[model samples]
Target: MTTNAELAARFEEFADLLEADDVEYKPRAYRRAAENILAHPVPIAEAVESGDEDAIDDIEGVGDAISSKIVEYVETGKIEELEELRAELPVDIADLTRVEGVGPKTVGVLYRELGIETLDDLEAAAEAGEIQEVKGFGAKTEQNILENIDFARTVGQRHLVGEARPLADDVLAYLEGIAGVERCEVAGSIRRWRETIGDVDVLAATDEPDAVVDDFLAWDSIDDEIESGPAKASVRVGEMRVDLRLVVPGEFGSALQYFTGSKGHNVRLRNYAIDRGMKLNEYGAFDVSELEADPDADPQHVGGGQRVGERVAGETEESMYDALGLPWIPPEIREDRGEIDAAEAGALPDLVTEADVRGDLHTHTEWSDGNNSIEEMVAAAENRGYEYYGVADHAQGPGVVGGMGLSEAEILDQVDEIRAIDDEYDVHVFAGIEANVDAEGAIGLSDEVVDALDLIVASPHSALDQDAETAGERLIRAIENPAIDVLGHPSGRLLNEREGLAIDAGALGEAAAANDTALEVNANPRRLDLWGSAVQAAIDEEAKIAIDTDAHRPATLEFVRWGVHTARRGWAEPNDVVNTWELPDLESFLH
Candidate 1:
């Protein structure tokens, strides 16, 4: 069976190939269609299998042409047009594009000029100095590719949480509906909302483990069963690996807690328990003060042997932590980084929730590369009951793609349009611009352009290969620019795509705090820049943060939740995020 991920991947490849062929318009169309399909709540393949041809129409960006392709792949496991494209330009577009400076156009050039088709081929051509022989290719560009080839090859093994979570949700929903399964939930780093996931780990509570395992093995979305047993199973669903573990209902909570761990957290907690003459493990917390414990036991195993003493708690996760005389630590903050100590001192933060955000400060529309219009994107924000929304389209500067930025005249016209719509609905629409920060940390927006907007989100778009000190200084200078309201995607990194820049988070935080600029936790999964650890550093400096989605369309507007979770992982509270404040407070911060 084709999972949503599998179906979406085909279209992504379709888009890449189309872009490489220099096909205009259709590539963006295919990419948007692919995005909608990937984010669709249900499995489109299963809907097609059920003979619902209209399933494709239900997806927002998909139209007749893309719909037929979806149906074809679902029915026959092949897209004929995609196959033809592959035959025409037989290069590994995905792998080649993974290199830092390489893109679809680069792939096309290399494949045509140097007959490079794979990472090995690209590497060979670069090593033999054949790449530089091609026009438009230089020593620096070839060296850049050679440097990034191996890194790109190694990073593909992991999946992004944005891609894997939907699959995990589908799996959990499926297992919950199966007979004899009482409770089901996701586990592992996915549970912690980590940016990248190794695999989806799920746990099931059941009285009949064998029955539940059998039903899970029969899941229609599964592509291959890696292994199976009465209470455990592993399966391959598309490119993601899923491991399911079953425990009796009596130990469900403990099992959930055990599986949802950052190894450091579990180890720290177990040692804390040991210091108290107690034991903690997957089986549950135990009061083993009176029992003989072995010091020579394997240090790698938590509590050594499971169920070794009088079981204090196992039925509920809260109880397990209660047994340790501490409050339950949130999974996001359970990365050992002083969380156990914080819990002991009753100093755990009240992490910000998704509902707390009042608006998104950085977003896009048809004025830039975004698919939607400003009116349409604003409608989406109002639909979510946002008190305010910011329309920050791209401004022409360095790294602004293909003149997809607003000129000064365009900025003035957009401000007029935004003012006309500010109170048109129940929301406040703030006119904004996402200005590109140049190599020397200058935002190219003129005084007239900056004065015309209510917000400015300055972001680094190019020169991402600077040393740590250079990057930190560049970002600090940008942050100090009085006209800039938010610093966007601090590192500019794209998960599994590129290691964008090397930034010192602590120094950036200091600069941002001193300048009263809010650091952005860009919610876009591929670029969750100012990731958890960085956010924490910013928080330590008492610098404000904005959990903006950097949304390019309506569907992506909801990606703010990913940002909220990343902030939680950073120990951020409602007060730390400017958008989480009331409308008046947010407006004051903007001013």
Candidate 2:
């Protein structure tokens, strides 16, 4: 089956190839279509299998041309046009363009001038000092490629949480529906809500392991069954690898604990158990000191003795931790970074949750690159029962691609529209701009335009390659701008695609704290900037935090959950986030 993710990747590659070949307009069109398709509620394969071409075409950014191509790929498992373009370019555009400083145009230039078609070829050219010989590529450019190539290679393996999550949910639902399955839950990093995941791990409690395994193998979503046994099965679903383990009801809790681990956390728990004359393993937590030690016995046995000793705790995760004299720690904070001590001391924070957020402060509309209109976005926020909604469209400036940012005049016009819309609904609609902060730390909008707004979300959209000292200073300047309310997506990193700017978070947080500006946890899964550690540093400095979706469309507003959990991981409470306040209080804080 052609998953939406797979289809999106194809269209994105088509865009890159088109841009590389100097083709005009089509690249952006293809890229937009790709983005919409990925976000579409329905699966592309299901729509294609229904033979409903209009259903595919109805996707926000897709048109007849892209729709036809999608159908072709769905029916034949290939698109001839894309294949032709790949043959023509004959370059690994995706891999090469992933380097921080490289884009499709640079990839094309390197390919045309030096026949650099792959990372290996690019590396060899950079090493041999050949890339510098190319016309526009200088010695510095060559050196940067060599430095970033290694990072890019390692990034390609992980899938963004947003992309892998839907498939995981589907698999869980499918397994839960099967008879004889007693309990099921997702384990591993997904359970911990990591920003990115390598694969999905599911654990099920069932008396009939053989029946459960057979049911899993027969799942329609399975593209390939990699391995199968009475108790476990591994399958490939779209671009994700899913591993399922069926354990007896008795050991479900212990198995979950063992599987949902950050290796280091488990090691700490094991040592703690050993100190108490107990043994902890996947099967259960058992007291093993009374049993005689048998050095020659098979270590695979649960407790390394014929008598497994007194059973202490194993039926529930809470009990397992209770047996160890600690509170049940939230999975998000299970990074072994003082969480165990906090649990033991009964000082674990009451973490922020999805329900605690009052509204979204950073969102876009058709005035910028967003698919939905201002009215539509506000309605979506209202649907979520938010106390307030901020419409922060991109302000016209450098790095604002495809003329997606609003001009000074357009921004003023949007304010009127927002005000009129505000009167029509219960939700307070605050008109604002996601103004670009230049390298020198100046916002793009004029003082008058910025002052007239209810909120101002200043973000660094360009000069992302600056070093730590420079980036820190650049962000500090933006924070100091009196008109700025929130420093959006502070680092500008795009998950695996780009490393973005490097800065000292503690210093940046201090500057933000001093300036009375809030730093954003931009919850667009791919760009969960001010990631856990950075969020913690900001919190330590007493700087305010805002968890906004940076939503480009109505449906995207739900991404706030990702931001909320990320804040929780950083020990941020409801009081720490400005958006968690009521409308009047939030407005007062902004003022």
What are the lDDT figures for the candidates, one per model? Answer: 0.88, 0.87
Model 1, span 1-591: residue lDDT tens: 787778888888998898888889888788878777776767888788888878768787888888888889988889999999999999988888888998888898888888889999999999998998899989988888888889899877788888888888889889989989989889999999999999899998999988888888888778899999888999999889999999988898888888999899988988898888777778887887877645787532434567777888988889889998999999999898899999999999999999888899999998888888888999999999998999999999878776789888998999999988786888899999999888889998788887778999999999988888888888999999999999999888888889999887888888888998999999988888889989998999889999999998888887897899999999999999999889888777774
* Number of the top-ranking candidate, with TM-score as the measure: 1
Q: What is the lDDT of candidate 2?
A: 0.87
* Local accuracy of candidate 2 as per-residue lDDT tens digits, 383-428: 9999999999999887787768888998898998999999999989
Off by over 4 Å in 2: 52-54, 289-307
Q: What is the lDDT of residue 326 in candidate 2?
A: 83
Query: Over all chains combined, what TM-score does candidate 2 have?
Result: 0.95
Task: Report model 1's TM-score to 2 decimal places.
Answer: 0.96
